[model samples]
Target chain A: MHRLILLLALFGYLPAFTQYKPLDASTINRIKEGVAEAARTTNTISSDFTQEKEMTILKDRILTSGKFFFKKEQQLRWEYTHPFSYTIVIRDDEITIRDEGEVRSFNTQANRVFAEVNRIIIGSVRGTLLDDTGFKASYTQSNGNYIVRLTPLLVTLQESLQEIVIYFSKADFTVDKLELFEPAGDFTRITFSTKKLNQPLSNEIFSLY
Target chain B: MRSFLFTSIGLLLLLSGCQSIPPRHLTPVSHHLPSDTFLPTAHCTLPTFFSPPTFQRALFKASMDIREHHLTGLLFIKMIPQLRSSRCDNDTVSLPAYRIVCSNELGMTYFDLEVAPGVFRLNYCFEPLNKNALWRILETDFRLLLSPEAGTTPIKTFVQEESNYLVCKSKQGGISRWDLYSPMGDTLLEVRGKSSLADPSWISYAEYHREFPFRINISNPLIKLKLSLSLLSLN
Candidate 1:
């Protein structure tokens, strides 16, 4: 019955994982090179992403589409623009969240979860997630795209998430999609598109409020 | 002597902490309408509009204030239709919903509960949050919020008080429940409950027409907890 709910939550599409079939030494190095090559010259990334959350209790998917911005040295912004307004910005290890008209800021030093999430997201966009010690990593290929699945090893994180899946485009080695599966069956999928990299993004993009 | 004093103080502190639930003080409401004659009966018939509301599906950003903890999450509610074979059974059957399947941003489920029309099912809850007292208070809050089928009628009605069209009062034992309705009595503006056993709790509706309230605010002054939600989208 839980599996049935999960299938419906995934919109009737049951994603079949063929097998773990971890890539061999040479293949792993090649994929790692692809990721490194993409990040070598990239300083900024700006894209529009559509986020979808699935809940067994909800018949229809909860949809929230937004624009994403990232700059080197750990600067990022996620601005939701549909249905409601919300924004989150990260700069210099500090996270700022804006809900409606209120703005609140917190530093990574105070919030380990925020710091870890920032590291995972930013690291995945770059080529640093391969070195993250908090998760056990595995690789799989489907439809020519490489999927790096990271299972949380930390007990605290494991309680919140079972796995994090990042889909890297085989062509550019850039992360095209990110999916976080919870300890329970619910999951959230975020797809990024129309990416602009190596552009001169302003620091003001990460401003509060 | 020191040990005896320490033990006595500890016992006193523990007793005080156990009384976290405050006693409610309810005063009789005075009629606002001058020259009004009709007094509401003890068990008057309530319009279906003022009854507990049922929804097919609803999503709200929820926050709970309990002591020093401020827990927040997304609350998803799906109303399941009761299966009925014959026309006669349609009105008699009730389904379990408002079992709020709550989750955080990472999608970790916090808790799932059926607050009304069925047994309170604590299907899943995160540890440190599985307190029976807190759950009971939460269940009472949700019940007052979603009980669209609540059949209790007003014992008294207050008309045209502070821009409100009408307000009806009901009581069961020591608990007092009040329902404020729009001028047409088609929309329920607020639902308030108070009892000697617990503190007062109320839910206010705003920015809505028809059956669904676009915004809801549920708060308990005694607990210093308030949950404010706006309808982002409805399908």
Candidate 2:
């Protein structure tokens, strides 16, 4: 269940509808190379994000807004400011979460679920998840973005999550939106805006203490 | 053979009756009026802790401690006003419907449920919480918390002289419940009842601000389950 929590964390606002077509093998290779190149050049990222969760049973959407930060390799911070305040930061092998002003920390190495979820989060942001063998990847191209649909091949993940769709900007190959769909017809969407790339971030921002 | 069968059935009933809910101790007041004593007494008005109109929606930081597992999440409740069928001459009749959804901090939903008077529908439930036993417990808790005025059963009111608290007792679907109210009759302090699962349970509400309780605690000692909710916001 905890693993399902972070897998569900890769959520954001939905993007405008657009026609998408499958990319050819050659085009897919070029797009992958471009995304890899962008990931290599990007050292840091800070952005404001809005997440909306919608379900068939619910009449209104659950809306939340937050700030996102990431440093190269494995430093990440997700802070929710609206509705309620919650913060999760991952540095190296340590994962820290501050909820209701109470701090809890866990070692990723000690928890395989956390380690896998952390890897997926960072990999999704860096466009490195396209190479993850755990999921079957498919590519689609819209007028404004290249969308990668990852269907989890792992049995445990398949029980809760149907698929994950990430939308990358065609120009810079940066992530613009993310969506996670569950087996119960519920979906979470998140959109990133006002993103600053390669910004200098101090280490203290990742500490919850 | 028929006589033997009847004897066995009588013995089973006697044995099962031994495990029924323990009767609550109430100091009898001579002048108290039970609801059944009044005319046209199909339903009685009981003091409720929550006002439906003012409390259309609420969001809470909820935690559940059951046995060795502790889960934390955000609990969102929305009150949807349901209208009676147009077939009825009075179309103005409205019923309170509650939609409850609980999700982790990361926004993963654990359960989605709709509860109304004499109505319960489970729209969605996380695989881990998709147990019949758990559902029975949750259903009873929500029904008692949200809509105690289903009006299906007659309620009897008593004045407890020792505590100076008005106690209301009702039996519905074979489960007996007792609600204790403050002296003013505007606030509900605690609820003690037997759950549908035959587990004795108790719930208490406290720290009211703006006519809403900021803290709620539920306990089922037989099952070793405890749930606590703190108000996060009024959504």
Number of the predicted model whose DockQ against the real structure is largest: 1
DockQ for candidate 1? 0.37
User: Judged by DockQ cut-offs, is candidate 2 incorrect, acceptable, medium or high?
Assistant: acceptable
Q: Flag clash pairs in model 2.
A: A12-A189, A12-A190, A12-A191, A13-A189, A13-A190, A13-A191
Candidate 2 Cα errors over 4 Å, as ranges: A1-18, A92-94, A107-117, B1-25, B28-55, B80-96, B117-119, B160-162, B196-198, B233-235
**Per-residue lDDT for B1-235 in model 1, tens only?**
9999999878765654454332223222353434454444323333342232434666776566666655555677666545334466546654434546775543456776665454467876776677776666666666666653355334665554456456566663334667767755566777777553445677788877566677788887656667776665444
Number of clashing pairs, model 2? 6
lDDT of 2 by residue, B43-70 (tens): 3354444446576777888888889766
Q: State every prediction's TM-score relative to the real structure.
A: 0.77, 0.79
TM-score of 2: 0.79
Candidate 1 lDDT by residue in tens digits, A1-209: 99989978776453553434567778778888889878777789999999888765544466778899999868889888864577789887887877767787877766555566788889987788977888998888877578899999999778667899999989889889988877656678889999988888888889985
Predicted structure 2: lDDT? 0.76
